[model samples]
Target: MNQIELKSLLADRSPETPAGRIVRTLSERGSMSAAQLARLTGLAKSTVSTALSELKRSNMVVETGSESAGSVGRPATTLTLNPEAGTCIGILIGQSEIQVIVADVSHQILSDATAVIEPDYSPARGVEVVRELIDAAYANQWRSPDALLGVGIAVGGPVSPITGEVMRGGIPNWAGVNLHEMFGPMFDAPIFADNESNCSAIAEMTWGAAQGFEDFVLYTLDLGVGGAIVSGGRVLRGIAGGAGEFGHVVIDPDGPLCRCGNRGCLEVYASFREPLAAAERHVGHALRIADVVRLALDGDETCRRLIRQAGEAGGRGLGLIGSVFNPALVVVSGRLASAGALLMDPLAESFERFSLVKGRDMPDFARTLLRPSAFVDNGACMGAVGLVLRHHGQPLNLPH
Candidate 1:
């Protein structure tokens, strides 16, 4: 019952020990019964019970509640991490937007805020905006910044995992910008950073459609087409943290010039930019991505056609992914995903046509599963929170 010993045991971030696995499991799943923990952690029941006893004695874990099935005579008590122990922050450094989400050790979001910035905002300006957002979030919530345990940032583009520097391709203004250097001065706690698409993947895995799947790909169709790849429960960050950058892949060497300075990158065609612009022209005014999606869902053929085309183009890139990883699941994300069947149906049809593996060629269990994301507006933000919950760090923070 040595509480200090238990804390010390759980404090180690290295994933080598049983205690580390247990701690990570608790962080990922807010609350669970001893049996559930044993099942989730794949640890022996006796081992889990022993660990729980130590954790509870140290005040690191607390008995939150109990669950009872209708036919069950006994209630199963639930245990959760001590909410008073710590807190975490998830920040999204997006294109023309910024978001901040605060949550406690128990993985419960306490407050969320967003700020919209003009395109090509300076790195210094971003730091200032993030600082103000964090301050405001804390001030409004009456939460002490001292309680913050870690911070996870979801950047709009490719990030250098080793140096925490933003790559030039995703966010032009953020080129050579070091994430840790940019935000480290604002907080004493650790920071985690990753690209927005990867963050979105993390969110999907933690709480959305990919919750139970260890391997999946997140294909985003929005103003920009981007994605992340997950293999064996780990995000496959290539040598330069560019492993899952599906959008930047040059599909046509002679095609239109892409923002990434590449010829015929998948993003140029697959991205919703052209369709969104078309929608604006048709509507005779500026329109948000969501606005177009709503119009399509409401039975506007023009809008519907626009989305369907985007889905078709997106599937071409997705098909290439199918040839490469042949992932077991694909989570279609971003604002366009909100269109649901209107988007997915055509997208799936196109995927089946273009992909090397066809549904008819594979059994039900082997066919790639495609699902829409749960959160449309705040997916990256939630993934930012996922970084805290899952301990997946970008360059800003060191991972254990």
Candidate 2:
């Protein structure tokens, strides 16, 4: 395989060539019919056909499978980049866990693994653990990391845009650590990093519920209430990396203190942390967010009531987000989202009650659609892989 040519085309953000556009589009959207590619790339059918022919001839693109063409005609041929072209790594440095995903250019994940770490682990220690995980992943796979194109890091919190540092308020020990500096020497390929929520938004937009949406909001109603905003097919990472911190939004001045060192933050009220504790106390055992959701789904009244209350509380935060962005779609994610309608129904009602743009006032098409995430737990990690595929040409930069 011409790894050099494929790598060059992947890095060429501004394609200027039909083949380049096709490769980039495939990398971002995974497998699709040639007609779908032509529509997505906005190229003439003849132009796409000609470029795809050359790409296939060069062993860059390959036919994956066939899918029926709706209720008419024969099955359309599905196509994707050859899986042997090259690989990309996506690492998630989360609050108390680290995840690694090795994937090929065709969007197939080769390996996925996670390791739990202490909450306040040092950045250097975190790096050591991540390196170990990556090494183990490749040891099991036949593919060589020699053709690695790039690496994407998804941090649990916001990463500074200008300084490239992990900002305060996300990971307690990660604040101020430069992500690019920490991971640059570990790999020869370019490094891309972003907030985990933003990565999740990319995952949703690329392969999950937010697919076909260029604009939407991802409200994560997890242990902590956080979110990400996507505008024009790009995540909006605010100036100081605090753009989508819905959790830290202060709703009251005299309430309890927040982990971000703020008082009366929406997280204090809306996050599932307190409710999870209440459920655990009621059951006399610790319960994961998912476990609580499952219990609720199984008709445990205490768990069900806790989730409903959490959803009602979470909706106020969504209402705040809705008032500001007025997004067309809000993909509710995180572990709590697994509760489905037990969370969404009340959340939607609360959103309509609190948001400035009332759902009753808008037309059916104009009203915002609230949808659950496709992946309850690993959306952000999958998005970490997308970070490399979607934004490989750009390299992280910080002041010297």
Candidate 3:
């Protein structure tokens, strides 16, 4: 089938068509057996079989060998969308960097690349850098840009769900920028957009720490402290797109000024920016957040102390989230999460101390579970890809 047909099937939200349901399910879940597809799509076995037959005949589906489902019978054959049918692009616009990833419908990553840019880079500069990166990503691959199905963008700042405009605070240069308008002309397919934290949550739900749980929270402790709330298997992008901006939450009205222009915001105290600066001074040179995390993991007391302190501060913010949502699982994300127990122990401790419901007071099953993100450097970008795969956050008036 052509790209239009494939896109139409994947983007079709109607539940009456078995073919559309099967295509969308495979796009979201990657490879699966007919039985699994039937269960996930809530279609009868005979209907799924018919749809699969039609899809295979149209070269839209392909057999991916077999996977043992740990059953007594022989392994069931798996099926996935034909990788040659179409491709998707995921771009991440970070504070000081830009990343691009290319993947097929079968969830196979073809290329992933990043470029470090100066801080406060303008939107024009960002588009240029992204174009270059995307070009380089496909330079060696056999796939052509014409096969691209859609583009998903993960912006560092909050994006209005209604307007596709970036909000002020996270990325100063990106504030008020219309992402769909900025990136639309560059592609021939539909464009999807969301803030980085929300994209990270999508990545977690699809492939990482929060894989099985529908109700959870993703708390990111990085140069900035931000998070995303997931309930009923959907990320809660608040009205005007300010929902999970935990970092901007004002904790002290009279405290120091924050980058977001708010005084004593959670990010001012919990972010790793100040700690990284301190680590740089102690080491007599500049260091990335990962460097301090590595040093702490290697038994550096100073680095360990910094991480512990940040964790404690982060936990206080997380505790507030706990009191508010009491999510079943909290996935601690960002570069600091790489420190492992050095960060998690203190964070969890602080969370227990400040939260209204103490873990000790609840049974093991009732206690909130905390885990680190599965992806360290690429979660948001990959989540951008998930946005396209799952057909989430599609821009208005976009053609199928």
Candidate 4:
């Protein structure tokens, strides 16, 4: 295989190159028909056909069976990038765990691994965790790490798209760390970095709950209440990477303190940190957020109450987002979201109660819709791979 040719095609950023665009799109969006590619890439049908023919001839693209086009007598042939062409790595430096997923050009996951760590782990420790995870993932696999096209990083907090410098919203000690400066020398390929919530939104759009929706909001009710806004098929990362930081939105001046050092922030009220602690206290031992959710599902009233109260509080925060964006859909993400209707029912009720656009006042189609995330645990990690494939937020030579 010509690793250099695949790398060159992926590295070409020029808008005039349809073949590069086709490869990137297939890598990002997975299998789709030729017409879908033309519409998505804004290229002419003839141009797409020509580019696809060349890609197929070069063995960079391959057929992935066919799907009915609804109205067609002949089935539309679905196409995807050849899995052997290359692979991508998605790294999630999360609050309590570091995860890595290796996926091929066809979006097939080759290996995945996660290592639990302290919330306040050092950046050096994070790098070590990543190295170990990557090593384990590539072991015994048929693919070679040398053909890695790129790496995508999903951090717990917001990171500057241009500088790759992490902002205040992540783990306590991780603030002020430069992602590019730290991770750039570790690999031979490009690196894409973004906050975990933004990555989760990309996962939703690319492969999960928000599929087919161009506009939506991802409301995370985890240890820290965070979210991402997807407008017109793009995540709205604000100046300084603070956009969609719903947790930092101050709801009261005299309320409890937040991790972001704000008083009465929505996160102070909506975050699952306190509830998880309470559940741990109730259980008389340490428990993960998923454990609490499982207990609630298994008819434990104490855990149920904790999750319910969290949902109500998180719903209030979701109401704040609804007033601003009035988004078409809200994909409730994070571990707390795993509670299913046990969490969503109350959260939706609170959102309906607090939102200016009352559900009763509008028609069903006109009102906002809320959907739980499809990924219970690894969405952000998967979306990290999406960053490399989509070429979204790829860091330049970011100097400290």
Candidate 5:
């Protein structure tokens, strides 16, 4: 490729050129054979071959494993973007914790780390802590910071799509903080940002339970309740990027006040806080959502009952979602989902009872499939990495 063309190719973001189209396809569907790429990208076989050759020579692509030969077809070799071209960082600025994930250009995670802090830590403190964690991570790795493409932040609040500011009603301390500016100076690459639930949805759509589905809902039940909605393979960011604020949806006007300044919102009852409080009283000590789940799985009746009640409460909110989106799939996320059948059994049963469309009333193909997340924890941070591999935005800045 000529220098001009090569630079254009490197700078190009459109999925039109053979390389851009191929990269976009890989980002969406993952590794594939050349034939599959041709089919998916609708590029002629010769064009694909030429582009692949150039990409491989430029260290932008690499050969992975191969799929089994079909009944009447030869085995086809699979290819993916080269892992060495660059890396991306995903960070989850959660309510009670901050998680950081380091991943390559090809979506392979190199390291994942987390640090718990007080619930209302200031943004300045958050930046300091995250910077330290990131420094420690790179200090232990062979990868250089110069190769990083970008950073994607998934906050535990509503993020304005245009301003990248955290909206009020969630993470009060983070409101009005410009995300791009907060983490921009630490790294030399570009930064992307979104809500934590949206990041979870991206993780699910990219590599987890909702892989094949274009539309789904990610309902997270933990110390807090939240969710994201995906429609036609794109996360539904409302006018203000609060489209999937399921937890804040008002359900009762006279009920307990929610943290978001609302009364009787879904999260008021669905969140694990109530259960955790009950567990603390019962256990006579401190307890985390994960600890409760483990105890429940171990057959602690009180713990089990607490989880069941939380699931039942969550269903009331999800039932409203069912009436609105009626998605084909519902991927239950967050730490509570790790409870497996202990949580899902009751959740599914309650969902069916409260939802507008009854599962028995629909055909098997039309039923809303429910499954737990493949990630037991830190899904949002991983999804931040997903944002980079997919080239959803400009490359991230490498840490100084």
Candidate 6:
């Protein structure tokens, strides 16, 4: 099949056709055997076999390798979308950086690049930097931009689900900016956009910690506190595109003001921003969150204490979330999550302390499982790629 046809199949929500089902499954799950594909797509073995043959002939799918299924018979050959078919781009517009990733239909990353910019950079500057990075991505790679199927943007702030406008309360300079209009003219492919946390949740569901759970919550603790709610296998973007903005949840009416112009919001207390600053003061030098994590992991008592305190504060907010949704799983994400057990142990302890449903009161099967994100630095960007592959959030039309 051609690029347009492949895009159509991947974008099709209906799974009535075997080709569409197989394509969607492969796009979401990467490579898998025929049996696994059948199980995932809920198609009969015979039907899958027939469809595989047709797909192979059309070059829509290709054999990747073989995996020993621990059976007495021969190994099962893994199948994936043809890498030569088309590519997709995932971009991250962060507070001080822009990242771009290029991947093929088979989920193979062709290129990854990032450019650091000043905080509060303009959208025009972001576009220029992104264009440069995209050029560099394709400069040495065999893949050409002509084969791009779609573009997915992971914005640091909330984006209006309908208008693709970056909303207030995150990324101050980007607020009320039209992302679709800003980035649309740069490419011919369809553009998709979502908040970084939501994109991170998509990445988790597709390939990371929340792989099997359809209903769960993602709590991000870094320079900012944000989250995403996944219920029934879909990320919940509330009516105003503010569903999983857990950080902005008002905790105390008379508390300290937050960047979002609210008093006593969860982020003001839980986010690692203050902690990072405190750690810098203690060390008498500038330090990124990762640096603090490294020092903590290296047995720096002060750094460790700072992280632990941040975790405890974060857990209080998480406890509130648990009280409301009571989700089966909570994936701890963001840069702080890279601290591993140092961050998790205390966070879990505090969660148990503040949550209404104590773990000690419930059976093991009924307890919520909290796990750290699988990705350290790339989850949101990768999730942006997932947006294009899964066609999760499409941009609205605006006058060019």
The pairs that clash in candidate 6 are none
Estimate, for each residue in 1-400, the C-alpha lDDT of model 6 and write its tens digit: 6778788887676767998899988998899999999998899999999999999999999999999989698999999999999888999998888999999989999999999999978889999999999999989688888988889999988788888888864675788899888998898888888889999999999889999788999999988898999998888988667889999899998999998888999999998988898999999999999999999999999999999999999999999999999999999999999999999999999999999999889999999999999877889999999988887854454232
Candidate 2 lDDT (Cα, 0 to 1): 0.89
Better of 2 and 4 by lDDT: 2
C-alpha-based local distance difference test score of model 3: 0.90
Question: Model 3, stretches more than 4 Å misplaced?
Answer: 396-400
Looking at model 6, which ten-residue stretch has the lowest summed lDDT? 391-400
- In candidate 2, which residue ranges exceed 4 Å CA deviation? 397-400
Give the TM-score of each candidate.
0.93, 0.96, 0.94, 0.91, 0.90, 0.95
Question: Cα lDDT of all candidates, in order?
Answer: 0.83, 0.89, 0.90, 0.88, 0.81, 0.90
Error of 1 at 337 (Å): 0.3
Off by over 4 Å in 1: 1-11, 15-18, 68-70, 393-400
Per-residue lDDT tens digits for candidate 3, residues 1-400, read 7667898887776646999999998998899999999998899999999999999999999999999978698899999999999899999998889999999999999999999999978999999999999988888789999988888999888788887888765776788899878888899887888899999999999889998788999999998899999997778998777888898899999988998777999999999999999999989999999999988889889999999999999999999999999889999999999999999999999999999999999999999999999999899999999988988854543642
Ranking by TM-score: 2, 6, 3, 1, 4, 5
Off by over 4 Å in 6: 395-400
lDDT of 5 by residue, 1-400 (tens): 2333332343456657788787667655668899989987899999999999988887677899888868877778899877776667888887878888887756677888999989989999999889988888889889988777678898877777777778764675898888877887787766777888888888888899888788999999887788888887778778677888888888898999998788998989899998899998989999988899899989899999999998888887888889998989999998999999888988998999999899999999999999999876767887777765554533333232
When sorted by lDDT, best at the front, the candidate numbers are 3, 6, 2, 4, 1, 5
lDDT of 1: 0.83
What TM-score quantifies how close candidate 4 is to the native fold? Answer: 0.91
Q: Tell me the TM-score of model 3.
A: 0.94
Measured with C-alpha atoms, the lDDT of residue 270 in candidate 1 is 92
Per-residue CA lDDT of model 2 for 1-400, tens digit only, reads 6888988898887898999999999988999999999999999999999999999999999999999999999999999999999899999898899999999989999999999999999999999999999999999999998979888888987787776788874787887898888888899887888888999999999999999999999998887888899998989888877888889889998999988788999999998988999999999998899899999999999999999998899888899999999999999998988899999999999999999999999899999999999987778888888988997325674223
Overall local distance difference test of candidate 6: 0.90
